[model samples]
Target: MAKKPKTAITPVRSDNYPEWYQQVIKAADLAENSSVRGCMVIKPWGYGIWENIRTHFDAIIKKRGVQNAYFPLLIPKSYLEKEAEHVDGFAKECAVVTHHRLEDDGAGGLKPAGELAEPFVIRPTSETIIGESFSNWVQSYRDLPLKINQWANVMRWEMRPRLFLRTSEFLWQEGHTVHATAECAATEASEMLEIYANFAENMLALPVIMGEKTPDERFPGAKHTYTIEAMMQDGKALQAGTSHDLGQNFAIASDIKFSNQDGHVVHAHTTSWGISTRLIGGIIMAHGDDDGMIVPPKVAAQQVVIIPAVHDEADREAIMEKCLGLKLVLETISFDNIMISAVIDDRDEVTSTKSWNWIKKGIPVRVEIGKREIEGNQVFFKRRDESPREKHIMPEDEFLGSIADILLSIQNNLLERAKSYRAQKMKKIDSLDEIFNYFKSEDAGFANIPHSLWDEGLSEKMKTDFSVSPRCLPIIDGELSDRLIIARSY
Candidate 1:
C-alpha cells in the first residue's frame, strides 16, 4: 500500500496519478464537477489563473493584428455539412438541438416541444459558423489576410470527462485567419504555434515540444496541423495547443471567395488555431508536487501572500497594519512587465492554516510578519519553489526591493526544472525492440523514433500493445525529419 501523506491531500503522485490529479484540484479549490455530467464549475482562484492566461495571450495576438470578435453559439446543421471532413470529425461528439422549447408532458415531467424544421448544433467548434461569416465579409482582395479571434465556450460531448482536460463544456480562444495565398496561411499557422509555445514556456513555465502532427492525427480538412505537446509528471503527454493550416478547404466549403488584383476570383486560404482550458491541467501536472501546485510566478493569481504572526492580542493590530502596508507597496511593483499582485490574509485562522492554504493554491511567495520581525524591521519570507521548511529572514526594505527579481528567478527556475525533468525522461530509440523494451517499464516517457522503421500499422500496433501514441514529427534545420516522439498521452 502507498504511504499516507502529511498534508491534506493524499495518495501522492507515484501512488495514484489520476486520483492525485483530482486531489490536487480539490486541495487547491480550483474547480469542481457541476450538476451536469461532463461539466465543471471553475472557482474564483481557478478563473483568476485563466484570466491571467487570457490577458497575456490576448495582448500578444492583438499585437499581431488579430481582432477579437464574438461568434454564435448555435450553428445550423447544414452549415457543418458544408465541410465534409470537418463534419465527419465532430459528428459523434456534437450536441444536436432537435426542439427549441420545453413543455409539460402529460405524465408530469417536462418534455421537449416544438420540433424545428432543421436541427441546430451546439457548436463543438466555431469553424463552420465562423467560416460563413468570413464568406460574407470577404469580397475583395483588400480584405485579404483578415485575422479574427473569439473567446467563448464550446461543447463537445465527452464520454470520459476529466475536469479541465476533457470537459464537455470549456472556455477557449480560437483564432481564424484568411490569406490571399497558401504560403501566407501556412505562415500564420506556424506563427500562432510559436506564440503558444512562448506562452507555455515563459508564462506557464512549462516546457513543450512543438511540431507538426502526422496525417492520421491532423485536424480535419487541414493540410497540416502544428501542436505544442507538454509532458506531465506521470510521464504522459498532453497536447497543450494546436494550429491548423487549412489551405483552401474551409474557404471553398463555406464559399469564402474574393476578387484578386489580377481580375480573377479565387478561394482564400485559411488557418485556425486554439488553446483551451486544458492548459490548466497541463500546469497542474507539470509543476505540482507532493505538497501541492507550484504556480508559475508570472501567472500566479496572488504573487505574494502576507500572513501576520500575532501571538498576543495587542500585537495583532501592528502586525496587520504592517501587512496592509506591504500589500500596498507590493502592488505598485512590476517584474518582467507584470505588475505584482499581493493579498493580506487577515482571516481568523492560524498562521499555519493560512500558509498551507496558499501553498496548496500555489502562491509564489509567502511572508509572515510577527512581533519579533516587525520590531526588528525584518520580514520572514519563503519561496514556493524551495522546500516548505526553508525560510529566509531579511530586512523589510531589502525584501521589498528584491521582490521583483526574486519572482523572476522563481519563474525561470520552474522552467529550468521542467526542462531538466523532461531531459531525464527523454530517450532515443533506433530499433523496434528497444522501443518495446523501453515502454515496458510503464513509466516510459518520450522516445525519438525514426520514421524509416515505421510500418503501415505501427501507430495502431503501438496503441494496442502499450497504449502509446506518436506525439509529433519535429522539423529540424528547416527540413521536416522522419524522427518523431512517441509516448503515452492524456
Candidate 2:
C-alpha cells in the first residue's frame, strides 16, 4: 500500500467535507469568530475580497440608473406591523430593543432602564422603513420611478452560525425601486436577477442556474422571486442572490400612492433585490480544493506575489532588489480593466514557507525570484488553477507582456470547470421515488424534476425524510420553464 500525500488542510475534503470547509477559512486567514455570539470578525484579506466585490457591483448598478443611498439600521415596531406578511416572515429572527439606556444597580451592576413607549427592531430587511421614505418622496407622476441602493449591515438572529455563510450581523447591499407601472417593476426585477447571474459567472467565476422560486419559497409580500442558485463541491446548493417583484403589496402597506398622468391616484409597483457576504462562502465552497482556496483572478486581492529565494547571505540583497523591481513592473500592467496588484513576500523566512502561504491565500499567480532565474533573465511562476508542483519558465519581458492574458485565462478556466462540474452532478428524474433513492447516498447532487410534481405534501415529506427542497424552476432562454431543480442546500 502507498502512503497518502500530505496536504495543507487536514482531514481532506473527501474524508470530512464540513470540517474541511472550516479548516479552509482558518488556513486562508479569512475570518474568525467574534466575541459576540453568532457574529464573525472578517480579517483584512477577506475584507479586501469583499471590497472588490462591492466596487465592481456598485459600478454595474450605477450604470443601470441606480442611485446609492443610506437608511437607518433600526426600524420602529409599528413600521414592520404595517406589512403583516413581511413581519410574519421575519418574526422569529427579529432582535428588538426595548430600553434606551442602562442604569446602575445597587450591587454595582448595570440593568436596563428608560423603557420606551414603543420598541424598535434591528432590521432583518429594510422593506418597510424604505417604503415609508418612498411614500413621502413620491406624490406625482414626475416622481414615478425612484431607484435607490444602500450598502449597510443587517442583523438577523441566527440559530446556527457559520462564519461567512450565516451570522447574526452581515454586510450587504439592498436595492429598492418604485415604478409607475406593474410591467416596469416586473422588468426591473428580472433585469436585476440577470445582473446577479452575470456578475456571479463572469466576475466570481461561479456558474449558476437562473430561475424563479416556487410560491412557498417567494419573498415575504412578494408576488414573484427570481434567484441564481449555485452548487457547491459538497453536492449542496447555495442561493447566491435574489430579486423580488413586490407588486403593490409594500406600496399599499406604506401608502405610497401617486397621481398618474390620467389624474388617478394609485399605489406604486415596487421591487427589492440584494446580495450579501454569504457570496464569499459560496466562492470558497465552489472553487476551494483540499489544498486551499482557488480565487478567480478577477477578484483576487493580490493577483501576483513574487517570492525571493535567497540561499546565501551574498544573494539576499540582489534577490530582494529583483523581487521589488518585478512588483513595480507588474503593478503598471492592467488586467480586466484594473491595474494588477502584486506583492513581494520578502519576509525573513524560507522560500517554501512564503510560497505555501500565498498558495493557501489563493493568489492567482506566484512568481519566484532566485539567483538562477535572475542570472538567466528568466521568470519562473505557477498558477493557482494548476497542480502545486506544476511550474513554467519564460523570458522576463514575455511574462510581463502576457500577464493580462494569463489572468483572463485563469478566470475563464475556473468558470468552465464549475460549469462542467454542475453538468455532471445534475440529474433529470421523473418520479419522487427515484429522487428519494438518489438522495439516499451520502454525495447526492441536484435532481431535476417536473415543476408540476412539487406540492405541499411532497415538500413536507422531503423535509422530513431527506432534507431536500426545491431550489428553483429554471428559466430557459428568457422564459420560465416547468422543470424544477431540487437539492439539499446550505
Over all chains combined, what TM-score does candidate 1 have?
A: 0.98
Model 1, 222-291: lDDT tens digits are 9999999999988899999999999999999999999999989999999999999999999999999888
Report the backbone clash tally of model 1. 0
How much lDDT does candidate 1 score? Answer: 0.91
Q: Each model's TM-score, in the order given?
A: 0.98, 0.98
Cα lDDT for residue 469, candidate 2: 88
Q: What are the per-residue Cα lDDT tens digits for candidate 2 across 1-490?
A: 8664588888788899989889889889899999999999999888888999999999999999899999999899999999888988888998999999999988899999899899999999999999999999999979968899999999999999998899999999999999999999999999999999999999999999999999888898999999999999878999999999999999999999999999999999999999999999999999988788888888888899999898888998888888989999999999879789998888888888888888888889999999988899889999999989999999999999999999999999999989888988899999978988999987889999998898899889888898998899999888999899999998
Each candidate: what lDDT? Answer: 0.91, 0.92
